[model samples]
Target: MESAFTKYTPTEPQIPPMCITLTKFLTTRIQETYNVCKRENPTNIKNCLTNPFEARHNYGLDNERNELIVYRHDIIGTFNSFEGKEFSMSPYTISRYEVIEKLGQGTFGQVFKCYDHINNRFCALKILKNKKAYLRQGLLECATLSMLNTYFDSNNDRIVKMYDHFMYCDHLCISFELLNQNLYQYAKERRHIGLELNDIQKKLIQLLEAVECCSKAGIIHCDVKPENILMTENGELKLIDLGSSCFENYTLYSYIQSRHYRAPEVVFNNRYNNAIDMWSVGCIIAELFLGVPLFPADSEFDLIVRFVEMLGMPSDEIIKNGKIADRYFKLVKRTNKYRLKESFEFEWENNIKLPPHKNYLYYSSLHDVIMKNPMKLSLNTKENNFIIRECLLDLLQRILVYDPKERLTPNQALNHPFFTFKNINDITPKDFYEWTPPEREFPFKVYGHSVSADPEDMLSDAFENKIIINKKLTNSEYYNVFFTLLQAGHVANITIDNPFEYGSITPKQFIRVFNHQFSKPSIPKVSTDVPRSFVAQIYSVTDSFNSVPIKKEENPLTIKHCNQSKIIIHRMTDNK
Candidate 1:
């Protein structure tokens, strides 16, 4: 009998001593049991002896945790059972909060007023949808909100306060202080029947104070339109909608301003800073007084034109430093056909038109309407032509300057006499809200709602409104291709009529001919170091003044200086 214990030899050297001791103890017990049961039955004694060892082995196997511990050889010492920590439910996740009403939907989220169940407070909860398309936009909104929340955390009265942010499964909830209504709705309701000058001054002061708060924090509310300015129930002006806002040092690669209130520098593709906000503030002021946008052009180009029409074109020196100098200057329409050939002359009566609306009656159209006006309060009291003409028109004109750098800053506007009133802070919210107008009942239905109005239609309308001006200006046959090349900064000029050809040519042949005309000057050097032949080949394809066929071998040497010059000139000349 080969022993069954032979196969059960200790596998680990460290456990050999313990295994031997256990085996000895088990054998002694088995021998005693066998001796006691020898007279009864030899087979029964053998079975009883093996059964004790087997039962002991089975008991060790029954404890899985203990078995793993024993396998680790106790090198890690004693094992303690782990218990998970208890987590409390988020306050927002509770279903006890009462939903009062929906506020308005933002670009990627919807806002609603809800009563907090935990705190029993009224708060506005902005629910952000985790949609794939708006992921980046949603992130931007969160970043902006978090930044603003940190900055305004200390100030409670002047700024809208962010209460809490909670995550419920896939949704993110942003809680903020509940406010009454935005200035857009307020202004729309009170159009025509303007607020009393005293009340307006009070509101302006509150707005200025809010501006001061932002400026102190080194923030610029890039989007300062009426929709972003909110009115508290107390009539205090609070700046809201930090989604389009950024720090003073931040520069958005793309423009992020409302079209109507966009600064001229922004419209012209110029790099802008805090001054753009001032321009928006001016637009808001103009809207408040005149009941409409100051420069309501049909398109961006038209808007720029309207701005220039009101404030006059910027100086060449001003244009050069701006980002749009290379691109926009070429596109700006020149209307100054009245310049004198010899010396300067002024003819005020025939050239100037009476300032457009009733608002112009208080300011001089010439002095206060554009470049010359510096947004100051009208001091003239007389209703005579000179006084009436020198008052509001001039004041408003200074506010609407095309050059943002030249426009009145928020602080500067605050100090102006227009805002100088004894009881400026005394005006309450009830004064502005309670004094209702007849127009309050009639809301203008601007955007039509229909299932047919899909994203394609909206996109088409946007493209038509934004790009049609450029397209219409470039109506010549080669304008599209030529303009594209020009935008890329090439130096070639485009002519409508080819001096070498009399008949109309196809676009391909036109390119070939154009390429041939501007062919590079022949390289005189024959040194192998310069690759003169390769250079010449490259110049041959790119230097053409007409459309020309290009070969693969000559591609490396082709100068293909696309006619960026033509685009610039076309842009300059096309601004009708």
Candidate 2:
């Protein structure tokens, strides 16, 4: 067997200053590389560090522990693959740690179970893949853990604690207190189709608590599948993998949440919230009961169809607002209804073109699917089973609400009778925490003279109040005014026009480049809803512009569609 570490003389190498501050005691060149590695996305962070390079600070003598605290990172020819660690004379030379076996691989790193010589304990060592970007993501995971660690202390076993962090084979490594097989493995071994009610309840309660702690710090475990959950020797569970998480309201990337457990808001492309986590909670619970994914689809279109079939078609407003709706649904102008595009062609032998895409559509009920599918697990007595099944389904519906606004928060799920818990407030974190993220640079610049994205809109259920302003104003200024009306009037979401560059032009932008003045501004008491594309074409003016009367002309203007609801603009008249 290879011994842990080979002797090395104490020395410090010249290194540049780094941005991150994980440790203050160490000063070495490798430390700087660790900092740069953190700025990248975890998946590709290994590509950032190119140089095999100078020695990094891998070990520090701990006076209190009376042992060497090691962080190993070796790259280039010095360190081969993880397989080579078995041959190295000094393999993973921590104070008293012995390498046992490889645990598993993560999104961007590998994990190993090591026996600690000093503490005589087994801990999980996560060796990150070499790359500056991946290093940064790992650092983020550490930061997230750091925040959670404050809530849990040395005695508390509520969650997995990061024992220490170091560099191993040019990869950032985080040490976690050792945990047993995750719930997935346990379920697979014991309960193939579904887990018992009691087990599900116990597991959910602890998992929910972990989620609560994360939300307390405004964290979102974007990936919340069973593989990320580890079980303790006891029945208690621990939520692992902080690497893929982000803050609650904001997202680091659009692609988040595992697809099978993905919430509708995330699927349809709407602004999301912490409720996305609860949605996963529902899927997991149902999967435990049914032994398969509740909503399984190979593609986004199929997923939408599943939802539509189960819950009925969503509102027109929802269909339009969804970023990906047009890809799956066809709008019927005459009927004023949206229909699902042909997901699959049936009656193929007949070559039925007459039926059309809309003709072959039918929606199945949610309750019906659950009962008919292979997922219906038989419980105890029919009476007892019926009651339990009803409660579980109810909980699932609330968590799986299509509108994120209506979806149950983690706290709410705690109170659901499905968990046999009553007071939702019982799970509220004692210490609430949040952080202001750095300013977000514009996501992706739209390259065009006229950006076709949604502009600010002023929509309301009642179009009775119409306050018109000048036809000529900057799009930015119009957007400013759009929000001003909402703040001033107190309104919710609304819709507006979307015609070409402005599509017929939505939230139409009026430019004043013609240099002709208007006949004073007028506020019209508009009726119900504004037509989708309400275009204003300037026709023949009074002969010679004498009778028409022109006010002082302003600068040329460009119209931008207000992405919101219906809004009408007119210059105010000087009349009573």
lDDT of each: 0.43, 0.49
Q: Which RMSD values do the candidates have, in order?
A: 29.6, 22.7
For all candidates, the clash counts are 38, 42
**The best candidate in terms of TM-score:** 2
Residue 306, candidate 1: C-alpha displacement in angstroms: 1.1
Write the residue-wise lDDT of candidate 2 on 229-344 in tens digits. Answer: 89888878888888877544235556778777787767876766566787787778766666666666666666776778767787888888888777667799999899887745
Worst 10 residues of 1 by lDDT: 77-86
Tens digits of per-residue lDDT, candidate 1, 253-301, equal 3466888788766775665656677677777766665556666655544
- The regions of model 1 sitting more than 4 angstroms off are 1-98, 131-153, 322-328, 331-399, 423-576
TM-score of each: 0.47, 0.54
